[model samples]
Target: MRNLRQKQASLVHRPIAWHVTHWSHDVYSQGAYSTLLPGGSPAHRAALGDCLDGRLVIAGEACNPKAPAMVHGAWDDGIRAANLAVRAGARRVIVIGAGCAGLGAARHLSAQGIDCVVLEARERIGGRTHSLQLGPVTVDVGAAWLQQFGDNAVAREAERLGVRLVGTDFSQPLAAASDGPVDGIEAAWEALRRGIDRRLPLTEGVARYLAGLAPAEARATRYAIEGNLIIEACLPLAELSVDSLDEEGVGNDDHFLPGGYRQVIDHLAAGLDIRLGQPVARIDWQGSDVRVNDALGDFCICTVPLGVLKTLQFVPELPQPQRDALAHLGMGRLEKVVLQFDRRWWPRSPTGYLRWYDTPASWVEWLDLTDAVGTPTVAGLIAADAVERQFSGRSDEEIALAARDALQAWACAVEAVR
Candidate 1:
């Protein structure tokens, strides 16, 4: 028994909170990989295999079959596309979208003495992986954490570039509230794994699957278990597919970049012919020549996001299978609220993450930034449809108040439990 009654009087040590709204089209929508809908990775395969008349090449995390939706996947795919372009006897290549994939391809092409240009829609280098300066410390607003540092491409790159990584404790929840700890969380987790092992081709969503097991009798306990799953999937429990969840697979030694993910972008974008604020509307490709917007190239590599690609038109419209694949793939919405405080108020726990069961699914996980940056700042992540449904219409102040209230309730609950 620990002394939980030693909670601070005020829930928040600081009144400043930064609400960053990441739209589906601009930053990201379909995070990492698509939900294993009816026809899962087949669509991804079709898109990757079907390159417009051999003149246009598709490269991005989505095109990667083994590791889709990962930064390293996108990087590797760019190199793969670059190799394809070179094999096709292309002297010059124009890479669309200066994201990780696009920048990666350009870097490889440039190294091979192949002329290439990177066109980005935004004025910045990183697309979704943006590092924002919050108060005295700088934190990554998007794509902050990296799983399995050992043998991981992104991790290797970070290490080679001299970026620091802080390990995270995912074994236990840092804090739980209002429901007196909901003691059966671990058992519920084990039940989920058992259910997964038993019913393999689980076409159903996680919500119904877990409900059948009746892992945790308490509603709060169930929420805590599901909340963690929801954050990982970045989708609502009902919308998430069990097959996709199983296929994604987990990594070991999860770590966060205390120096931010922007370092990776900077390292990848060194000395490349990058053109910013270039929103390509159309791509016209014939036998040996391809035109991106207005630029001409022997071959073109398209690396724009699925959300952005959905809006753009290809001259010889993509094949039926490719169109179907794009239609079936969905974008995962995420909302982050980062707060900086003057003093550290939360207890120092080995588990770096916190979850509140009573709160709506929208505001579920909070990552403590105190250890990483030596500042009393915390980031609250809200994923799935919850971002648009719960926090879209609300103002920053309202969202901040709701979050503060939730934290207060959790703190008060901990005190009561002790």
Candidate 2:
């Protein structure tokens, strides 16, 4: 990794002094899930089981079979685990992390008149949901959008927090297939939608059938299906399980939060007693009680991210079944690069660019930010795999140059349409 960083630094044209240093250089490590099950290969489970003792209940988006790595799913899991712990007669329950799940757990407990403590690993709350000051406005560097329209918990939270929903217009002129002129972009979109629609039912049916099988059988089938879907959807289908889709129903009513999605976390964390910048080093749950040790001291949570649990060292290892389940789970990598332009350089459009490159580094989507804010900022080249790799060591200049080149190509394609 150090060699990679040095190589990245050497590749850039500008002086090393001009390059911005990433404090947390692990781009894949987005701290997105504080209380989610860690999904990976069998090896991931072996590492994860090292942290679990029987009493330390694991709950988070990752832990959820349906919504393994989404913010809302994690939140829901935390709440359910907290409720379970309370019902199990736990007197004082602590939330191990302060992401959406942790906050959700704490909020539910508080609502139920149960006192809980939230321990966060960062200085501020919200694990992966965060915003940054960009000149005059705040830009969301973490979670920027909500999926599934108004039905999802994040969307509902956005509404409750009074965050305005704005539509993304990707109607910009761009290069299209040999089908026709620039106007054919609409046709391309329609075709893509139709394609997705046709395959979606098949995928869903397969998922449902696989969901009922024995643990081993289900894991094998679901893993294959999910791997394919990740490539097709550019998202982990496990995070958008059949349950979530059924709950939302079918719709073209997706929405984005104006103040950034992080505001939802802020609203959720209000008035809650949270401890930040405390990373749990160990968890002891062999005894009747559960104990979590960070740099500060020992605390307790009804549940923790299964991934985190799997990594932490436990005095006594977890049982084989739970360990096996953890091993079967997997984590998909999704990365985003938000570029704030000095001016709105890209053409206007109702639909964003859905590029199809012959190479692995091809960006899947390019979102326009003109409607979201008056500024010229544009979030472009949102690629899952490549971005993760680039984040490892690429300098800001290298990223900027690459984005500029892509934008120039897109701009030319749009001009050809005009």
Candidate 3:
């Protein structure tokens, strides 16, 4: 036992406490967010949001073409679904999947004197936007950043709730305790992508681009692409489209709600009729009235994630457009690991990002939350193949060990280089 303990200690240092998100394995979520496949277009997203038979509407982040995979988009689409349901003469609504979208729909419908019943699979209402009190400070295990702050309703709600929104300048990442290089590689990517057929899956296109390069240069560029672009897409390059690069880009500044992002979801859910631990086994939309389990309503707005929606049983089936959209659109995996130390083990300044380009690249980029939460915490994200390869089937302790080892190895490499 003593030798085993010593071996473990030598392998890696441990944090006081840690949390990891197994989103892909979650039956309710099945994925972190939505993404377009090789042939899917933005119109597919619009199609997914379309009202079915004027009595049923599918609304969620995946449905919002303007900003799919965003909290504001999910919230906005939920409100949109509610308005459409009212227009269709719905006085009572059954909102499925008590996520941001369901909460948004319920909030809108209830305000308009429409009776709304929200059924959530999980005990929590936030869905993938859950918040947890890790150690001394709160950490968002799901969605954290308030993107496109200027037009984001989520951000606006945060401010109204008196939550502090801290601006993050991602351009100034603290790498090795110094401002890292900010060479926007769009120019290089364009040169590589210039003549390649855009319809090819991102991997094929990337392969063709890298094929001509020398071995070392190709490896370095590939590493950058994996760390930056692949991480952004949250899916394997083979499943992702070349358009992902353009589709994933967000304009305007993103703010971090250090006060906890769950506040916005809670505010949206306040005073609403939400039933937790009630998963809709089936949604029968065969007639004018849609039935969700024991509850039946004139209209049902399903905000269940695309990942879950694919597995959900809908009687008589959804429309061709919705079915087609679901077929073409894909869900992307994004998993997070939050490590809280007894004290700050990293820098407090820059407070944005710390990236490591080492081999394996499992926990390559991390968000420094030490400054935001006033606690010594760092969150690292792994997506796509990294999630499946390194994290799947691994125990939480083992995953935590992997991350600590990666960080330890990175620090040692930096010191050796110095």
Candidate 4:
């Protein structure tokens, strides 16, 4: 357990005790789960195994390694799983969960002339990519940006669906610590470019080492460069299996869509049969045909999130290896706070503001969203742990106040620039 001071220090802004308690109460009331399991991986499938009586198969983004934790990645996996099940002669397939994965599965199955019934627990579709209206403007509470969109299926699908693509303006000026202008913003960008360049050789070297091919097979320097790229992505080059890298490297550069990412899910859900407000409570796979029970009639999907499956009681129990793998597969937590400002207060240079505070409770990075949206009414502040804590016990007023202070400081810094 972290001490109050330590916890406060970790936040982007010092949170009041009352706010913390209030946030905690809100979390409990909402039944929000803090621990995350990486969505979109095979861990769920492995855990469920052949328990689905050969009639049921699980497929979702969580089952794919390369696309783990991504919306389109999950959708692609869902489609593949549905296709596999259809080929196996399963009739009247059911898709559990109406998120991107489920919708993707439904869409693909529909295209292939397969019948699929989608069950969504929420009133609307799009799972984690949800949009909410704030003061006459609809904002994304979930996935906002498409990341690298061109290479992404969601981006392509969005384009096909007439969803507009917007490029993020990276030309905004940035402010640094203590409400000071970041003099090194340009230098930092140059250094980052150089770092990436420097890392390429290292990546290539590691790739060669794993392939067991002679350094002469590819320039040793090239292997080193590739190895460094892998490392930068948080995967160690030496430990990365060649097969895994080959599979994972399929799509690297993708674009982000404007409006909201949820549009893709909505588009996918259109024309598909979906039962909303239905949550699957249990799964009985002992029978020849798998059964899933919710408020609505029981239906089965080939795949479910490992997090959901882990809590579910399996009569025969899961295999040890599968269970262990599920346990080991970690999930990352990301929170986005969109601050609606009265006006654009930050610097307008290409390099945006990034602040590092001596205190733990200050925001680490703030980005200008003015260009993404027509108005300068919104800015995004990202502080991982602090934001998580903020969700615990703080009131909306308190959270807003803290955000205001942080933004005010940043605004001051921006104004200081000539």
Rank list by lDDT = 3, 1, 2, 4
Candidate 2 lDDT, 212-276, residue by residue in tens: 55664444333323222333233344343332222211123556665776668878889998988
TM-score of each: 0.87, 0.69, 0.91, 0.67
lDDT of 2 at 163: 84
TM-score of 2: 0.69
- Which stretches in model 3 have alpha-carbon errors above 4 Å? 1-12, 175-196, 214-217, 249-251, 347-349, 414-418
Rank all candidate structures by their TM-score, best first, as comma-separated numbers. Answer: 3, 1, 2, 4
The best candidate by lDDT is: 3
Model 1 Cα lDDT, one tens digit per residue, 65-156? 66666667677788889888878878989999887789888988998999999888888887767887887788887777776556467788
Question: Per-residue lDDT for 156 in model 1?
Answer: 84
Query: Stretches of candidate 2 above 4 Å error?
Result: 1-55, 168-252, 294-309, 352-358, 381-385, 388-393
Clashes of each: 4, 23, 0, 57
Window of ten residues with lowest summed lDDT in model 3? 175-184
Q: How far is candidate 3 from the true structure (C-alpha RMSD, Å)?
A: 4.2
Q: Answer with 2 or 4, whichever has the higher lDDT.
A: 2
